[model samples]
Target chain A: MAKAVAPRGFARERVLEAALALFAEHGVNGTSLQMIADRLGVSKAAVYYQFHSKEEIVLAVIQPVFDDMARLVRIAEAMSTPEAQQEVAVNGMVDFTVRHRRVTAVFHGDPAIDTLVNSRADLSDIIERLTVMLLGTDPDVTTRIVISVLASGMYGSATDPKLSDIDDGDLHQVLLDCCQRLMRTRGAIGDLRTRGAIGI
Target chain B: MAKAVAPRGFARERVLEAALALFAEHGVNGTSLQMIADRLGVSKAAVYYQFHSKEEIVLAVIQPVFDDMARLVRIAEAMSTPEAQQEVAVNGMVDFTVRHRRVTAVFHGDPAIDTLVNSRADLSDIIERLTVMLLGTDPDVTTRIVISVLASGMYGSATDPKLSDIDDGDLHQVLLDCCQRLMRTRGAIGDLRTRGAIGI
Candidate 1:
């Protein structure tokens, strides 16, 4: 509805909105600049004026996710204990995923991240940090899978079509429940890992 | 290794192998019949002789997964208890994923699944069954996410390049531990659902 009524100056924001909608539905690989232009009822050149490539648009689309991650990490850092940090990590993920269920479906659904520049390393880092924060240590294979399940569990299923009938409130509770259950805080999943970069 | 010397009569088998490789690397949407034929060093007509469309080829590629799911379900049904049934489901999944980590990555990674013949319903059914089997009941969102995390945790992470260095043996153990911990086995998650078809 907002896209239908936005005036001329909002083309960049409009492009992002259309691209996100297309990305959510058709997937990043399946979506095209032409599709975004069509969604905006504008010329491909006009869309091009704001962004040169699909890769650029995708980065802009997911930039907020990066911001959100940074914010979550910062908040998590403030927590005094590993268990508290784990709570922040789990709840933070649940809240973010729940809020943007469809948007996340694009990235987590197909890992279209690989198609982006070299963001795979960035994503691997985020999952790694969350894994460390969630468990508070260097993971054995078991805890590593915990992160996989914990991360994709909320991200993947939030957008699962079969569960689409499920509403947001219910979905939030479900992810919170699962992440909390799966988190097993152990020996030092804290400052030793993410903080201070090369800590002692 | 297998495709190199299978002989001319194995065009059908070779085509499947090449197509799977292309799908894994390029994704189902990105992969083309020409690409598959090129990989086989054959004409598109020859590839068409084996399978008329990419969709058909995809179905054939994942048919084994369907067969495995059926076999696992049958084996689970024979088990005397839900706990036993859940054990079969979890271990069966871990073993299959560890063995075909890359191949499963093709499907589980991008869910090129959506492109395959409405296997969305079929895939949803499989996830639902596994979720129910693991937890043994009609789930609240919490348990549903458990299956998502559990399934994707193993399927999504098995081929995660970051953890790609880990061997099959360790991957198997990791998945087993994660799934075992997550399966809570509550209420009557048993014959009332999957078996007897229309059971009371």
Candidate 2:
């Protein structure tokens, strides 16, 4: 079955994209292998040829987004100043989230997917590093809590109908503004600039 | 089956509490009427006596939270001043969310629940009223957008494990501070305070 599968270099990517759309509409549990296969106009065996199981397909879909998030955090970590790192990381994360809002929603809104995200040590590790980077040194318990809340807000808020019309660019700016206010301290603006991000 | 139910008051509350716990752990799809009954140490017949179906149980659990949030917004709407109302509304919401995070989590996390929440006009009306109250009259797109982001942040931020340890009092303060930063303009703030909330 594997040998007979299409040789397209982007087979995995194609499957993931299709899976995300179907997962979003019908949910991870509500969706099935056959539905995804039908959506792709491929047979069940073709779908199976690409992915070993639904779990593997789901992980494949979620991995790219988390990988993108992890990459942004890594870049922000490379920045010399804490403030700049925070700004760039915050903006990058928000923008990435907006870009992949539906995928993120499918992940967040589905308990099975959520369980998978939380249970995967690799994913959790990436999230932990991002949290540490965001929290910085000497973060009080309160700041830790606020940052956590802000992250969820970014993910969950995008799906809210009241906020539906607000486009990505504006949401990015608004989130940055909120983050700045939450983390504001003396020299914060200068620190942000040093990392190549400007604060208005 | 319908005739075997308990008094409407006790049966409704008992069924809701059991359903919420089960839903939180097993998810809506993972959970069943039998499971809820077992968890509550009751018979399947007893469960059916209380709730006709899983949908009814879910509706019973979700609507109350929406109603409570609506009540909060209504109280905020009655205030003559934005400062007082903002302070009260923000604190109330944070407290409400923290106290009922599990229910909120189920409400936010489950796609089935979210779909149901979206389709329920009664619930949507309350949420819309709350959003409009936050946005105020003549709200420019920016104010509306920021409020929407903040609202999303509020619910999203609550369940994050990173923010899990934050004490309720501290979280409440942080949310209030974030709210102030989000509603930055005087005219917007003024309109938000003066804007009348429509009753459902």
Candidate 3:
């Protein structure tokens, strides 16, 4: 994103909002800068003045999420117990995914991580930190697979044919239930749920 | 597939194998008939002579999996208990997925499922039947999400960056363990595992 002497937050928000809508409909790769400009009823130069490239627009749109996770990582790291850290990590991921369910579905449902966002080591590093906080370091092969499936499924669930129709709050609970089941860690909240419990 | 009077299975196999290889590298949509011919070291005419279109080639390539599931569905339907049927379904999927891990990755890993194979009712029907077998009738929303995550994860795990490197046997066991855990069903094998047990 280009920074102006007086950053027009209003113009930037419009561009980002228009770009997100277009991305949701046509996918990140399919949406063009021209289309975004057209959607905004603005000239290409006007949009260009805000964002140099389409990727920058996407980055700016998703920048809040990166910031959110960075803050979460800090909070989780400050905690002492693995269980507490994991709760924070898992809770943050589930809440964010649920809060922005539609957006997450659009981006992840795209076949390949478009070269648009591909090879971003910083994003991956944050995700990795959150993952370790959730599963702890040096987890066994089973834990890796379990968490991998849950993570993959959680992202895809928003766009899933059957799950899509369900309410977001219900979706969040079930996903957390799944994560807890697969991880099989009782932790402090184990008192609330019966052992081996599977419910909505 | 063209019904050659001779029904030359040998030539057909060569075409299908070449098409599969091309599809793996360049997704179903990216792989053209000509590319498959080039891979097979045959003329495009030869490839067209074997299958009427690229979709036909993909259909032929995945035909065996459909047949395998159909047969599995029959066996599971005959089982008396839901648990028995679920085991039959789960075991069949795991074994088939592990047995054909590379192919599964190539096809399922492709986004949009390729218009090459999209909107195929017969494939969806078979998958639905298999899902019903595994999930039983009228499962709760929680069960649906848990199984949804597991099933989605199972298909995608073959190509998942972290899980991809795992040995097939270990992957199979862990996936089954995850499924059984989320299902929370002791079934006939509860005795085999300790209560609420999760292991690789």
Candidate 4:
């Protein structure tokens, strides 16, 4: 049994935090509820009171990130122009990813998380809306490729242990700039740069 | 029992191809030697004859991709200038990823694969060399971030089922262009364009 720490805030929140840390270190399949309870310094019964199953806990852990994604989609959808939509969506995503790096890292390569995320109709709709907003209506292969690439970059860099030495503030800005460069068409590059969308 | 098809090259090679396809459809954990044998229309003993365990099968499946990566690293190292090195490394990576999208896709969200890949000292050294080649000698955070982002994009887009309708040639060119765009410094953008490095 691992040493326990005092529970913080809500019992639910503490369980999630403890689970996220364990999941990050040991992976989802490797983690057990007992470990989460041990980390929380609570009884296994206490942990079960908050969530019935490991899957439920997994869902709860990811819920906030999904909520943030949906919120960002809503905000981006209200923007009138594609450029504004793209800017808002990209910026929001980067901010969310940076803020939740640890949680996201835990979910990053886990297939169980992928299945759970894909099964949610609401999340799918949000992702579709976000995708359209980023690439506009009738996105071609080029647009899709560029957007996916930028996403990969943002997520990979944020979670990369190799980049631990870099400050989050600096990392965020550079990631944003790189994404903008990838997103912009050759013709729009000059205009976007002039509009101060490419960099801080 | 799967319907036996004529062996193409060697029994070992045939088993690997069949296993790769099955593994891609069902995850490594979800797949078994019995299934591979069934796919090959052979007995489980035959499958075992080719490879003793699933781990060995996985290694054989990934061996080609790793070989290609090593080859690319050597090619990039031979280049005289940093610019040349970056271009060669990026182009090679995109090409390799696109070519082996199926095998890569199977490996994509699997943690077991991650552990296996990371544990290999040779593979790690190859990846390190490839990263250094792409980012040059003394890469800043921005360079590292950009390289990682482009990488994410290439792999993600190449393996995405949603983009299946898009022709490989078109996807390849677009991916290369996006990678080049992410890689070039603002000052070098003009020079790279003039040199026709940004497109096919």
Candidate 5:
């Protein structure tokens, strides 16, 4: 049973990796099965054997990120306090986003991916769960907006060409620092206001 | 000369407004001149008379936003200090983004908009200028990333469905509060660390 599953799993992984690269470069609309097959140095039929359609391949490519997100949700859930859960969840998300920068870029800018993710109940459920964990039970508009900013800001910076010169460790540290600053719950805006950080 | 330009300008403005609505609903790639014309109840030729191509319409559609950004740069530049400039820039940007939520949504997610904006040096230059105004002369990765989060966060939240129930005034105040918290320049990360806001 192990042997039977291993080869299929290996092939599927290869297909997804190739498809992701193609999707990143040419976009989902521009990429075709033939190009993916060519990149893999395999026949179209072999590609079809693994994934029936381009949509399926796209779904497969995104599945691992969702899996990681699910794992993050589980880790956060095990934490004792709400604060602990928020910390674990935010750090886990930042690490996942940075580690998968290429995949994140594809997901970030692609309309096809947006439609697919939004339409899929499973994906949206995971996102809703992540949001709940991040914002807590009684989050206000400020908290929701700040959380959204923290996320997209991380994604945007990670994929920025200007910051490509910086090493990954430095980038990761900087992102975490900025995210933590944005994620501060108590007296953050008031402190900034008191210090005249924002002009009236 | 005024007579010649007035009618053309009015027609051009109508064409752009119609085009923006179609682009928002159908996407830039999915939109066409005929659709813009159909929406405006004008002939395709009349639309073409105002703007030669779909690309021209897109450029025209975005020009007002760029004009607002230019106005923001001027406002920031007139401020007395870098800190003042940062405050004004962040606040103005948040206001602009929230006020123009529909157009921001189109710009935020559309690949066609991305390609067009990136290709045009004028648009990118405005963005660079805005970044400089927000971050000052020499910003580290953290500052840059945080500024990005503030901007995209405002954009994301302004268009959020859950936040739709929020009135414009309430949404604006919440966004401002959140942005100010994220935009603190001096010892931001250090403050977070000292407060134990970030575990690391």
Candidate 6:
């Protein structure tokens, strides 16, 4: 199970909150430790005392969300049946994603993060865990592709300007519907991966 | 139609290319015209001569992709029937999106660009044209949501690492299948705004 490297504290939480706001306001590439310290009314030394570097701070900020996802995956893996497990897990993942849209937005919006994660085997391992959960047991390439597509679709739909006015309830329904359709279509295309996985 | 602002020259194209690479490397907020000039072995003044500001350079980089999408939209609109037009448009849009995945990656990856587009009504107009083309005349809210979801799904999937090794032809087929599924689901949902216009 994924856990925080540092214990939760008022200072760390404050810094993370500031980082999220600043990162969202000015892309992650745009925000700096000095800026984050300034936003928090703290000195750079104080910020450094809590987190060693900007990258560490970013990881700290994103780690909670990632852990939340990992926890969900663990739950899904613990399920008795793939269908029940997938539906619950997929919905949980969607809920987690929607609840943390800013995280999703910031994560996908910064290319630097992509490079960083791709370069680190540890980070890739974390992602692979989720991918494995997303694919269930022994999924083929095509099944993996469909799952990836559905997840991205859900994330994109949440951030889409065209659906900006959609309420959370309606947005959730739309996501559920789209995911179900995607899964069904995958099965129809000689896809055996999600054989009995019902609604997402 | 959205065309290139002017003819391309090596200097200008080189600047734009450098700017994109840097912007993609560092977030748009992190990248500067000076950095781009330095990377290109050109003076900042030379860079300014080609593009006055970083924002202008970023827009120029994305313009070609937008133009291609707009052209495809126009082609789809020119079709005789709505079904035929949607099929053509969907296929064309998917093609353009997949073909220019790198460029599309920029728009989705950089929050600064997303902010710029949202804040600048004029810039948003370009995306508005694509949305209109996708939805057709008087499309409802749900339709827009589905379209956005499907488009995002296709985009995210194409850029996904798991599918990175898959050939383009296979990816295209995957995308086409996803689009067809979207159409089928949208049809099942029926019209949220109107009673008729049901079924695919």
Ranking by DockQ: 6, 4, 5, 1, 2, 3
**Candidate 3: lDDT of A93?**
80
Which portions of model 5 show Cα errors greater than 4 Å?
Answer: A1-13, A78-85, A118-121, A185-200, B1-13, B79-81, B118-122, B185-200
Fraction of the real A/B interface contacts present in each candidate?
Answer: 0.48, 0.51, 0.55, 0.67, 0.46, 0.64
DockQ measured for candidate 2: 0.29
> Considering only N, C-alpha and C atoms within 3 Å, which residue pairs clash in candidate 3?
none
Chain A only: TM-score per candidate: 0.76, 0.75, 0.78, 0.81, 0.83, 0.76
RMSD of 1: 8.5
* Interface CA RMSD, all predictions: 5.0, 5.1, 6.9, 4.7, 3.8, 2.2
Q: Which portions of model 4 miss their true places by more than 4 Å? A: A1-10, A185-200, B1-10, B118-122, B185-200
Candidate 1 stretches with Cα past 4 Å from truth are A1-16, A32-34, A40-60, A78-87, A109-138, A185-200, B1-17, B32-60, B79-87, B109-139, B185-200
lDDT of 2 at B105: 75
TM-score of chain B taken alone, every candidate: 0.77, 0.72, 0.77, 0.82, 0.83, 0.77
The DockQ for candidate 5, computed on C-alphas, is 0.34
User: Which candidate leads the pack in DockQ?
Assistant: 6
Model 2 pairs whose backbones collide: A149-B157, A153-B153
lDDT of 6 by residue, A133-200 (tens): 67878866567677878988888888665566766655666677777777765554453324324421
> In terms of TM-score, how similar is model 2 to the real structure?
0.74
TM-score of each: 0.70, 0.74, 0.78, 0.82, 0.80, 0.68
Model 1 scores a TM of 0.70
Candidate with more favorable, higher DockQ: 1 or 6 = 6
Q: Write the per-residue lDDT of candidate 5 for residues B46-139, one digit (tens) a residue.
A: 9988888999888877777888998998899899999899899989988788777777867776779889988999898888888899878987
lDDT scores of the candidates, listed in order: 0.72, 0.72, 0.74, 0.79, 0.79, 0.75
Worst 10-residue lDDT window, candidate 2 chain B: B191-200
